[model samples]
Target: MLHRFDSFLASRRRFLQVSAGFGVSLMLPALEGRAAERRGAERATSLITLWMNGGPSQLETWDPHPGTVIGGPTRAIDTSVPGLQIAADLPRMAERMKHLSVIRSLTSKEGDHERGTYFVKTGYRPDPTVTHPAIGAVVPYQLGTDHLEIPAYVSLGGGEWPGRGGYLGDQHDAFRIFEPGNSIQNLRARVSDKRQERRLSGLDVVSQTFRAQRQVQAERSLHGQTIDKALRMMSSEQLEAFEVDQESEATLQRYGDSSFGRGCLVARRLIETGVRSVEVTLSGFDSHANNFETQTARCEQLDPAFASLLDDLRERDLYDSTIILCLGEFGRTPRINGLEGRDHWPGGFSCVVGGGGLKSGQVIGATDPEGEQTSPVDPVPVQNLYATILQQLNIDPAEELITPIGRPLAICEGSLIPKLLVDAG
Candidate 1:
């Protein structure tokens, strides 16, 4: 059910293909009514998800069990916060830990890649009965503005399964931007305005005839709105948000020359322009073999970009208004395998959440010295994490949203983790 927008910008030389392709408006009026709820209110305005695609090793990350059998030679370094240490590989992030907090005892049972990804992203297991909207999809659907010229949810470097709109409809699907700083293909038209108008007019006639014959009033309305949204996106003056080149070379270098860095830069720009949610994914953390080597390489890519993003955001005074979340589907096992790698372990993991009015430099929970669950009362489930995120965003996790089929669904079906909030004790 993953949808890609890359080919949607394919050539328009063939009139039939061109005519069939686009819609300018996205009329999800269902979404418009669902403004962010005020319960458990926080003043956050945007979210940037640093999505560690594969399961990252908690031992090598925020919850390193140094000097233990499972520690695996990954030394812990002191962070800005006294007595708090993270993997030595993330030195830059270590210095930035004052704005960050770690939940070291997140637990889940979904180990398979796709299943785990779905659970983490949607706060629900995959269900054939109902395709759930991802957090990214939900935020924009609930908080997006009518006058927004930019797509509310944007994905940078998200591979095949970038999450979907589910019952939210195709309109809420993330606008996937494969190249962070570069312009998206086909955003500008090849033909003159007059020619384009003629083509659209012809398509309108055909659409009207089809609507008259099929009498699919709802479908027609949705389609028309989609077209309108597409059209608006193409001509948006705010489209400059995608241009990271506008940033100075020094700034770009600070974030690093990597795609992930560029993506973070683009994410910041998008947030400044009022995008509700943006996800920047870093792949290759699934270290079933050669765990240390692979993890070190991955951290080399993540540390600079993430640390730079936090610094720049704070420098610009955007930190309080934005939530920066860094996580993966699960975590690597505490035991190193025969191949010197770690297998997937959803039982105990770690995630870093910062800004957005969250209390900083605090560890929420922990694991035993043997890298096992410390207590049944300690583990934070995915649902609770999602609930905390929503609450911090000024959204009510308990508020129900009606699915297209008339079924009521809460924005997030989990209890709030009060310790994660700035105002909480």
Candidate 2:
């Protein structure tokens, strides 16, 4: 859907046939040039996003106002960090609190699922003029693609997928896999390497003619690059990272026996292999009805997996070099509705950020006792969150990338949250 290359070429099945018959492959257009080189010391080498989609409740997750009417039945539990408490459902994550920083008062104006997801992921709201790249897309752009065999960005399961490269082009789109531990389809070459070479040789003549025509060289280039990348990835040893079953049974148990757990494990593997950014989604957080029960269940699923991921990363010495972010488009309301479920509340919410050598074991902001307004602090906008992530990745948040329409847009418009940055060397 991101492109219209099919108009000029036959079906993919036929394109391969023509390549085999002709010799040279037509390349797809390279939309938008690569971002400028990383501007600062890299605080993190990779990013792992645990997307708690469908708008997780702030009260049941990181911002529980225990004993308050707004807190419902969710009780607060002590974390390893003194005086820092979270909802009881995430006891394991509570234990790992020393490795985390919770923003209890994240604020946003967009409450619609589509709009909030876009704002949080791209650091920009939906605009008629230009589509912005997701943080996942921008990270890879700033980091470059020298060592990546698999796509630089990978998305596990569903959700908004962070972003599909937006104006940065589909080249940066996440290589989507619906489930963890499943082999990617079409990865195996149907023909031998020698046969593939022959096919390429066959396509060379046709590609030359296509280039001579110059009617769609950019599109041709884009397609060729995409094919080349896919072919290389099909043969990449790094692809084995997706196989969660290869991990020990005990390790799997530590992460819990759920799809989200498997996804967390796979995320670790992908990050270890140098994938720049990866997002793992755990859906069904929308608790518009039966809010308490739904939130409790979702948090229970999130706890062990999230804790185990932190533990495994630390044991493997990957924790310091990786960042973990957990949040959704927005947070559910503080007031329990007639359905006993909370509605959307973009005014105040919570999110967790840790690792990447960030300052940890701290709470960034707070909401009132009733969980109504972001009290004692200004609201944390979506742009600030994006800026913080980019800063940790060594990408200058102020840098601009030219859009397809030639507009120079800043990667993130917000200033850095000093509390979240690494200590100056």
Candidate 3:
């Protein structure tokens, strides 16, 4: 009974849909958006990045090179580790020096803000062709943990960040949450028990029908995977873990009052409960004008919450297994700029790394007299840092992520920073 005209039209639609299902931009954009490229994720690795988005100045943080004409008001004080000094504002970190390291010579070739951020997040530099995957995406897609009910990566940002699970597909996108809502937004189902179950069942039927009727190899394969993951999320009885308020009263108080504190508390609980990655962002640090006043208050908010998070992890015996990184896209200028605030300085910045069984109490590299410039031997490129993170978690730093069109794009282009290797064989 099928008419030739109707059949031809249906075929054409199927072809167009299938073509759209795979895009070259799926891999690193420079890789011609090659499809199917995947990098191996380290299953045991877990990271909690305390991102201070925009830019935090090196003059006020980990790399305080006082005594230089270029250096500002903040003076460097010695840490527990000999021959090392950091800014006065980071008092807690100075005393707790045995657990941290400073990579003061981090320099980036890309001066533009957006592009620099992109390069740091992805191992490769920004290219026009392929959109790269953030480590958040790289986590669940390659390194899935066992018995985790919630999504692998959970990112808590007050507003939208230029975050993406590029080339890895939309399935790897983070479960985003913000404040006022407190817990994750849109994660709570609207319907009651009966309706929720019924709706899920209906979804299953529709998904099954679509797959059976429209099976075009790769498209069918992708859809099938999404459905399977969705069903697991739906069926999990432990989804309540996302709502950490289920814990005792004292547990919540331990993390403190601010949203960052709450976010860190949630991260601690998530990692303990088995989510692979959690990224917590604290905003307003891009103080381009009133630098000192802004950073002092910002650090005050950051200090207690950060210290407590680390302390809580150890108290729960999770410290050794979890890694914490506090970073920003770039550092502010050493010379108080024309605006009275430190402007963007990609020349030298500092990032803090701790736990995950890596070597601690180490200062990996150095910057010049005022932390204004990177010393030649101590240059820490963005790729090198990414590679070091991958290595610490037992991922093969040099592994090739296969692109969709069969080209292998380099994942971690640099070797792991030697000093941070803990159990590396």
Candidate 4:
């Protein structure tokens, strides 16, 4: 009787183990499907970052204090919005202020170019232990790129410090295009179609052998996934979105003839084709000397491109679904240096954000007009800006992602900027 009871107990334990394993296996697909559904519902929006690569001066751009000691020769001009005005250099942008909101008190701690760019782009300080994903990378990571044949993140006119995938892996990295409107190199096969197919098949055989030898599954290998994505993108009709020349001559003139202008136009095209994020960089903002002249030239390239981008988005009925962020690594110092230049100032600066259902035509914070106070009024941290953006995109900023090293990190650790959101206010 004792032997029979023990046998029954052992069999019951095995059955329970198998049942548990089976139950977990069944739960995984259901969980994944739910997650997919949620992502699909949330991913209708896109982000366009107009990166002012080098630090631009607040006094010469968004937060001009004309007639003040630190305001310099850059004058302030009225905008379509009743109470708001921007630098006279951005006359075109000034007229379209009703579609944008300027944050005049964006403050950060990293002043160096590399560090500042990483912080502003990633919303986290540099940590040797783990690199955080850029906002662009995070967009695709949380949203999923099942709908895109082209890379979800794209960088036009690549900058010194372009947005990176960081801990999310290289698959999320931006596809860099040095110039817009040019044919993408290496996209088409140099050989005949038959030869290309034969080569691909030969490569696949070798890849299969390699996977078998290593005991690695083909689907689990990053290299294999990358190759698959490349092939898909090569054949994708979505690649045509990069052709800015397809626009009319009037449209081209409206956006200006500069590279940055064309980049902005291409950005709109990419967004229309379901790209999660697009960054159009306008470099040369670093003005350690000749701040006024440098800023004026930069703004000339910026004003028309930026204003026309907003106009196009609104005209195409894409404005409400696309978020636009125009900012840089930091701002130039309020004090003009001996070389007639403004030094790097992470103390306070300005960033313009609007669309994606956000409130517009409003200035969020202010700077000290007299320039006596270095700290800005109602100062906003870089993390808060990211948090607000994530919230707008339907991503939970507090959600934690476990790193490969078993460390967990939150997407963002800051609170939302209530005034920036349409529903929050």
Candidate 5:
């Protein structure tokens, strides 16, 4: 059965609507615990996920099998690293390949969009028995929020499934922003300061009465907690982190004039402001038809933003302290269908992960050159990827968290891919 907190999150949209008078409706988590105590000098403090909403074709993106029958029209281009070639569409990312590690054999059992998304983001297949927390939620929960007034977990350009707090509670749910660089709504009260003060006072009185009627469950109520966080965020200086327009025209142009680009820029600012995890979503990758054209368009928007993010992180000296993950739920099938498109394939795919003290310029696995086999050469399970990420963040993968009903679950069940780590061989 779903927990009470789960029910609360289910009705969050209605709750926010009812509480709009508070001038803050973003469900910010009530962060508990002290700042993260680093276990290693090279551990990453934050994560930036460039989430490709739909499945992107590995043949057209990371694992280009140029000149092959299933390679389609996509060509491969050489990168800064010798023998490392990405899709020709992503020339910018290719140039910055020295800072990335391409995993060409990411495999999963979930092929449906929703299921795959949950699995990739949470490192677990869908379990009707329990809702699992996303890696974003797990990061801040393990590392603590570091007293960040802004939500430690933020999602830009909300997708079908933004990261959820799951058993971690609604407080860890991602604060959603539909548009990057846009001003947050209802941040300031419409009425005068005196009026707002009087309103809050009245609210407290009503809350006290409500609590009195349900004394047993009053302490568990998130109403008051949500209000307190809303007010704090309203006055936080960190709010400026969302203003991607504050960047110079040159910087803006470098990142491109797309929402995804702006979101990437905002993600950098949030990371700089100490937010633990930020995800920038770019949709339209579900190319079940006209695969080549669709992929090219998506890459046009992704290339600049992704490359610029790397440039800025390195420039600000934040690269070593930040983990970057660029991938989708799964990958497109190697076999081109009748519509000149590719279908979903969970067997063998590609994802790029680097930074956060990870070894760079390395390719972990490979798919068949002929693209005939459904499976890749050395499959990296989704859980293992999660394990590697948790280890890099100084979070123990073996650590267990208790569900609301007292069921214990480990943070991650997979083992670390030692080659990905800088210190590991």
Candidate 6:
């Protein structure tokens, strides 16, 4: 039922066909010139997704029902973003909250872990059949960045979304750099650049052999975009931006010494230089046995580092240009179990938003007390959140990308929450 992208989305599918036919030996300019010519735009328009891998407890973190018995041992504290109060452990984030907007009511139909995750990451419900690409992939597909030397999507920390360019083809897929320490693993330039070239040439010979015999289509099989992406990463200098150790000791300490903190720092640094979208996954939310206690520790680990990231962004004058998002697959149950934990609650949850010039210091929607899934005092869905984010980042939510067979799919399903927009801010 998406009304947009009825035209060119079909041709866009050929993007991957280009790489598939020729194989990965050669590279083409990404779709930047076209994206820049779009109708409306935003000056502040990059995105950083702070992914909480496991299903974080909703009762304990974002939609805390204090009066309810499930509220757990923690209490709420006021944030600098007045009218917003988060878990007491978020003292650091509390101070820089004026810049944040909280969405307390977000729901998805998928109940299982994988399904819920796909919903949040792709804006579309999972159909075990058609895999949806993560938002990082969508970022470059839409905006294409000004002049990115590396692939547009960058995932730091531990977790990463597995899907890529659903209908957009292999070339439009995300190039994930798994190593947290070094964005590129061992990409040193050897004695002669010719060595790597020769290797590529060898790859080309194999690909050409296949093309001569001819498959149904002229797509690269042995050396596809995925392989080429690795080759580019091996020789890329753009990865230097991921070095947190390069930052001053004081700066690193400010973000805290934990892995998640470092990941946050890395994401900011990646975007600061030129990466279009950097995702830092803070995994470890599946606290079924000791949910509350474990969440307290996780939030504590996240609070200061996350706060420092926001502060760092502001101090460096990067806040407006970049958007920060914190989310998980689903929220935990409202009732704590006998094991002293909460179960998955895909019915409703909360999300944190900042910068990208969003209308901040306001709650977009609400969940009822008792942490039960109910119509929000103001109702909204995950797609709205995705749509709002896209609009804020200057992406056209209405744009469409086609599936391989050529079924046009809207990039983002819902309309942007108008209240979250800045002119309305």
Query: Best by TM-score, which number?
Result: 5
Relative to the true structure, candidate 6 reaches a TM of 0.84
Worst 10 residues of 6 by lDDT: 1-10
Model 3 per-residue lDDT tens digits across residues 1-425? 10112332254335334433221011010112211121122224578888877777776778776767666666777888887787777676677667777777787765556666676667566766676777766755666555565567777756335356666655455656675115432234555768766765776687678767787753724555543454455445444545666766676665556788778877776676566788887777777898877777677667766877888766666767677888888887777766678777777777888888778888866666644334434778878887888766666667777766666776668766878876553
lDDT on C-alpha atoms for all candidate structures = 0.78, 0.77, 0.65, 0.81, 0.86, 0.69
lDDT of candidate 5 over 155-183, digit per residue (tens): 99957888888888777878888999888
Q: Can you tell me which runs of candidate 2 are displaced by over 4 Å?
A: 1-44, 160-162, 192-197, 203-206, 214-221, 372-376, 422-425
TM-score of each prediction: 0.89, 0.87, 0.80, 0.88, 0.94, 0.84
Off by over 4 Å in 5: 1-11, 27-44, 216-221
RMSD of 6: 6.6
Residue-level lDDT of model 6, residues 61-178, one tens digit each, is 6666676676877688877765677777778877777788888778888767776777788888866556566677788778755545455676676653543555565565544445
- For model 2, what is the alpha-carbon lDDT of residue 43? 26
Q: Which ranges in model 3 have alpha carbons more than 4 Å from their true place?
A: 1-43, 75-77, 185-231, 234-240, 246-254, 370-377, 423-425
Per-residue CA lDDT of model 2 for 1-425, tens digit only, reads 12322333344446555444333322222213221222223323888888989999988988888888888888999999898889999988888898899998787878898888878877787886777888988897898765556777888886644466778876666666778777765555567778877776665666667767784864734655756665566556677888976888999898878889888988988877667788998998899999999998888779999999898878777778788999899998888999999998888889999988788887888888765454427568878987887888789999989988798999999977878876742
On a 0 to 100 scale, what is the lDDT of residue 257 in model 5? Answer: 95
Q: What is the lDDT of candidate 2?
A: 0.77
Give each model's clash number.
14, 22, 13, 0, 1, 7
What are the per-residue Cα lDDT tens digits for candidate 4 across 1-425? 00112332354345334323211100000011211122222436889999998999889999999898888898999999998989999999989999889999999999999889989999998887787889998997897765566777889995877787777765566777889878775566666778767777787788789888875554434546655665666666677888976799999999999999999999988887777799999999999999999999999999999999999888777778889999999999888899999999999999999989889988988988888888998999999999999999889999998887888999998899988887776
Ranked candidates, highest TM-score first: 5, 1, 4, 2, 6, 3
Off by over 4 Å in 4: 1-43, 215-221
Cα lDDT of candidate 6 equals: 0.69
What TM-score quantifies how close candidate 4 is to the native fold? 0.88
